[model samples]
Target: MNSSSSQIDVTLTVKDSLLGDGNTGGGRYNYTFDPDLIHVTEHDTEIVYRLAKEDQPRFRIVNLYSTDTRDQLDELEIREDGAELKIVHRNTYQQLTVVSLLVHDTKHDHPVNCDPQVTNDPPPVGP
Candidate 1:
């Protein structure tokens, strides 16, 4: 068997907006893909956020999706402008807000539904 090269992983995380799961307010969904060889089917309220392994924006909400709450990444898009290096995301189910910013993953940001609050203090180290 042989492996493949030149692939990019698109991690899609979806969550339900209503019917709070009692203890939790929402549910999560996830999908992974390499857009170079596949078609991405986006819902009417979903959007895409592309980041480096270190959480830097490589591409933002360029090809914005329109579903209630979904995310997808697809194809190699050639840039005619110098804007792909910025951060982009949908603050809502509609419209986009691109920023030169970085966001820590919130419960709302995870398909696993974990909106946790953390202190800046790093974990205790051995003395």
Candidate 2:
């Protein structure tokens, strides 16, 4: 498990125009992941999720949950004062896993929901 195999950075931005005036709802925000879909390979020992510098002070990842718990992830940790998540995946058989991130907005004192996808499918053996 090479922890340094890959690193993913996530960013959060708000669409003020979509929210209209004086609205602080979760719908206004957009969460963008660098690779969007994380593909865990055999060499991957750890997967890290971090907030972009611009969004670090504004939001924090409070909790994370996977839709399928069995054979998807071995261990999960929320670190860096809830600004990052470290995940260890042992089973590389699962095709798709949806990880839901519970985020808290420090600026607005509200909660936001974000879903990220993870897959352990091996690369095509041959054409």
Candidate 3:
């Protein structure tokens, strides 16, 4: 979480294993998002999601929407090339926001749901 910059870049990559086993038709591939918890500071204004493997049949960001109505996002733009998403945040009071990503696995033709958190509050200290 770079407090100096107004924009944050989150890289999304496919995980190694499937969600289920052969019983579930091989299942959907899981994903790993760098900076899994987006610590959006007061100065941060935007979030940019980029694919880890460009032009690969692994995963594609199909749609993005806020699970919570009180989310801080002001705008969401999916790029024309289906490569990235530019999301602008509404800087109001501090709160935790949940954003869902509908990712399409081009290789398996499956849809995977990814929920990443955005928050202005500092992460809790360890035990």
lDDT assessment of candidate 1: 0.25
Screening candidate 3 with a backbone cut-off below 3 angstroms (N, C-alpha, C), the clashing residue pairs are none
lDDT preference between candidates 1 and 2, better one: 2
Backbone-clash count (model 1) = 9
Model 2 per-residue lDDT tens digits across residues 20-92: 4322343566666666777666533467777777778878888878876565675688898978878776644
lDDT of each: 0.25, 0.65, 0.67
Q: Write the per-residue lDDT of candidate 1 for residues 31-89, one digit (tens) a residue.
A: 22223122112221122233334222222223332222322222324232312222122
**TM-score, per-candidate, Cα-based:** 0.19, 0.75, 0.76
| Model 3 residue 46 CA deviation in Å | 1.0
Task: Candidate 1: list runs displaced more than 4 Å.
Answer: 1-3, 22-127
> How accurate locally is residue 122 in candidate 2, as Cα lDDT from 0 to 100?
42
* lDDT (10s digit) by residue, model 3, range 30-52: 56678887876544378888778
User: How far out, in Å, is residue 14 in model 1?
Assistant: 2.6
Flag regions of model 2 displaced more than 4 Å.
1-26, 122-127
Query: Which has the greatest TM-score?
Result: 3
- Per-model C-alpha RMSD: 17.1, 4.2, 4.6
